[model samples]
Target: MPVIVLEAKDFTSPLFLMRTCAVLSSCTAFSLVASQQSVLEPESNTFRVFCMFTWCFFFILTLLIHILSIIQFHSLIPISWKNLVITVAVLGGLMSFSASVLFPWNVMDRQKVTPRCVAAAVASCLTVLAYASESCVLCIQPHEQRGYMGSTPGLLKILQLWGGCQMIPLIVDVAHGLHGVHAWQLWASGASYSVCVLLSFVTLVVILGDLAGRCLLPFDRFLAGFSLIGVLLYMLATVICFTKILQLRNPGQSSPKIGELFIMETVVSSVTLLAYTVDLAFSIKQLCDRSHM
Candidate 1:
């Protein structure tokens, strides 16, 4: 048979090359636009600022509440284990504020704010450590303390788990930011925040279920209701965080749409602050009730 050969000119053409390049360029442009939009959208920045401010404000409020709790409910203080838990919780709150402030800068331009990021990372580590230590203390209180039984054990364990879960996102965020892993940090932060929210809801359900089984009195019901409010508020915050994550992932789709997510986040944080306040109030009431007995 006769040999037939194909020339390069038959397959290669200027028009074909041009079209391919155009398509690739379009995709690249779209990706860049999307990335820029995600980071620069007014709504996103606004929400970020709002969350930072809110966390800082609540951080101070929590400190004040803890101080008052210490003063007013001195008799209720657990000398050994509970004191450790309170210390962890207080320290965690302080670190949370520092993290919130440093997070925005870390995300915006980590190189310029490396020192701040490092500080934030240290604070986050301390927060996680404190919470984890508190959890351990609560879990092992029975072995170390004399009056560690009944509802106290159960309550301590539940709170320990709750605190531990809350620390997950903070740890993830800190780890990523400190290493300059922006993409991973954002994803991890979102996951951790979501987990905290889910855990909080689960905690609320468990608390209510336990109360239902043991307490039927009106006062007990009131306490349960107050706790439920706190849970609901926290749940709302989780939803807001979820929305923010989604917007961040799909940037440049629409600014108005993304704005809604930011707004939701702000609203949820506000609600969470209120819920925490109410929870503290209920704690005081419980302390009073115990005193009467």
Candidate 2:
């Protein structure tokens, strides 16, 4: 006997789907509200108030990181490479920090182009070169006995990658400032910036992974983690800024309203500020740890 089986409905009932969607929507709304309250309930003078403060914090953090790195190199590395790396890191950090201070001001004024863009480009270039040089030095070190140039080699390589990636945005910003470009040109520049920012973030993750996998001195491991957090935060902010610029240029088939863009930028900038603060904490912690040790 051939038994005919009734086929189940090929599709879900519209009513059921609608009910599920409603539930999901409610949950999402609740989650968003909770997140906002948690993130935004701070005092008026909170760190989120000014982007400049965040930038300054990260700048100082980067300086401290470089200083600690210098100290470590002096104590552990041979003298030949020690002075060179320390000099480059210190000078590069100073120049980079100074350029960061100038960036937002340039963004605000919009009419005047500042030499800060050029300085930033130069500083980023120097950082990349310096880190690459450090990596080479690490690779050649007699103490580097483990696989693939050891922990120090891996760390330096990651740093070199991060530094090199950041140089693109710096150069593009300099070019845009020098040429007095239009919004479209600025958006084009953002493409390179986006790529650089993404690469920096990936490098940061790789550094974290490297730290997690390898056994190293407590201070060294902490430094790696600390640097990773700082770089990651910077990259996140950069990605948001670049993405907003891209959206402004090409809003797609459904152009986002001006209100939407403003909200996005506000949200992105706020998150960026918070990340920068956390990065500062990490740097300060590193400095303290090094001092104690």
Candidate 3:
């Protein structure tokens, strides 16, 4: 008789423990929110709702992933399991950040902080930490040992996606004040945000689903071109945003929040622009490397 040694990737390994933690914390945090929902203010519910959505969505996703992994379901699919794992880890971390931070803020950032809110906050924070730990474990491994999405360019794509998501909401908020207020410039900025977010999202999906090479266009070249476009659009948007914000500050604007929102948009757009630019540079280098090969 031969004795079998379980691999680290086995369903009974530490990774499963991580997923189990994620599932439990998500459920606890969600239940706490629901338990006291009637007592919370309506205005606060918006943030709480977002928090609930995050918990419910990610919780289900975590369970499904674990179940699938246990049944060897990933083998039935074409997607690279490690690549999918790391990608999910990264995304879950980002999504859970809102649930952890903003949800707690919604519950506790008030004059009266209840015990239910405290418990929920603690659980949500633990949920975020679990996701973060999962991401870190995958990220800290040797470069050659991981999937493409676990690489530098792929991580940048995640940041770009997150930045884009954050901006779209703020842009809509800022647009509310635009009676004719910086109309064309705002439109230009908004367009940049919308388009970049869409492209970045599509790029990530193609890479994760392993469809990049199957597409009609050359993947690297298309990515390089799109990254260049993202850089330009963000540059335009950032410059306009900052210029308008400066204009607002020096002479004052209609509302402080309008200026505040633009300030946030400007910061995120700048960071996203930098990420895209670096990704573009890397893409160009990759193309050159491929050509040489």
Candidate 4:
């Protein structure tokens, strides 16, 4: 008798779906924090607003892909086409994040360029080209060819890579926060900065774990729970941070304006984190049920 071996799970499975959600949730949370920073600084600026809009748009589209994937919606583009779209979306997000970093928060002229901007542009373009080649190669290859990353590299690998790219800007922002942590009069601001650092470490660990071929069943249980706790802590810290920012804003500013800003940030962070937490918990529960059987 011959023994048969099963390939690792692919995009169609619950694990992949949950992993995708986890990546997007992390990105969304970071974007919300960035947007809040932009809002709290000086006057409301168009360039900053555009950057936030771009990132938010990317998050929504990726999330819709997750939903359509779960429902097996046939009306959507073919799987390969969907992959290409996602690749483009992720690249766009990368550009948006880079812009947020390279450009000042309040650039009035769109044509303005500096030495730093030039460097940022060059780096962003190179990144896009590299990822584009990878995405095209991944999409053009048949399932068998995609197997190089491992049988189960699946959509999780792609999503995790994208998530890691999106973190570059957030990481920069965190550096700034850390530098100014001592100057912050509000305790919440300092605490939020600490949480951001912790979250950054968590994201780095996740990226390393996936690349190290540790994204598996029992380990995933731990990753999922760890991620949920990190996100929850970040959200708690963010609410406090935003509330402090609002109170510290210009006294002449309308109360409604400040309240609205706080409300918006809270809602975006809460919704994204809640969705991710639910998905991770669900995936863990399923794993438990199967193990008992």
lDDT top scorer: 3
- Give the C-alpha miss distance for residue 132 in model 3, angstroms: 1.5
> Scored by CA lDDT, what does every candidate get?
0.42, 0.39, 0.77, 0.44
Which lDDT tens digits does candidate 4 get at residues 102-214? 34433323345444444433443343343344344444557644432222322333333433333333434433434222234334434543554454355344542343355
* Cα RMSD, each candidate: 24.3, 23.0, 4.0, 13.7
Better of 1 and 3 by lDDT: 3
Deviation (Å) of 103 in candidate 1: 2.4
Clashes of each: 0, 0, 0, 0
Candidate 2 regions with alpha-carbon error over 4 angstroms? 1-140, 143-179, 211-293
Best first by TM-score, ranked: 3, 4, 1, 2
lDDT of 2 at 247: 49
True lDDT of residue 5, candidate 4: 30
Q: Per-candidate TM vs. native?
A: 0.33, 0.26, 0.82, 0.40
lDDT of 3 by residue, 1-293 (tens): 33343456675666787888988998998898788744455534545666788788889988888777666566667766777788777877877775676555445655558788888888888888888888888888887656887889988888788778767556665566572247888789888989998998788778767887798889988899889999999999888977877677554454554555566678778988999999999999999999999
Q: How many backbone clashes does candidate 3 have?
A: 0
Score candidate 3 by TM-score against the native: 0.82
Candidate 3 or 1, higher TM-score: 3
lDDT of 1 by residue, 1-293 (tens): 43343346633543223323322332332233233323433323443343344344434533443444334443343333333334334334333433444344435442433344344334434434443443344445454442221134234333433343334434343343232224543454455445545644554444433333454555444444545554554455455455555655564533543344344334434444444555545556776788799
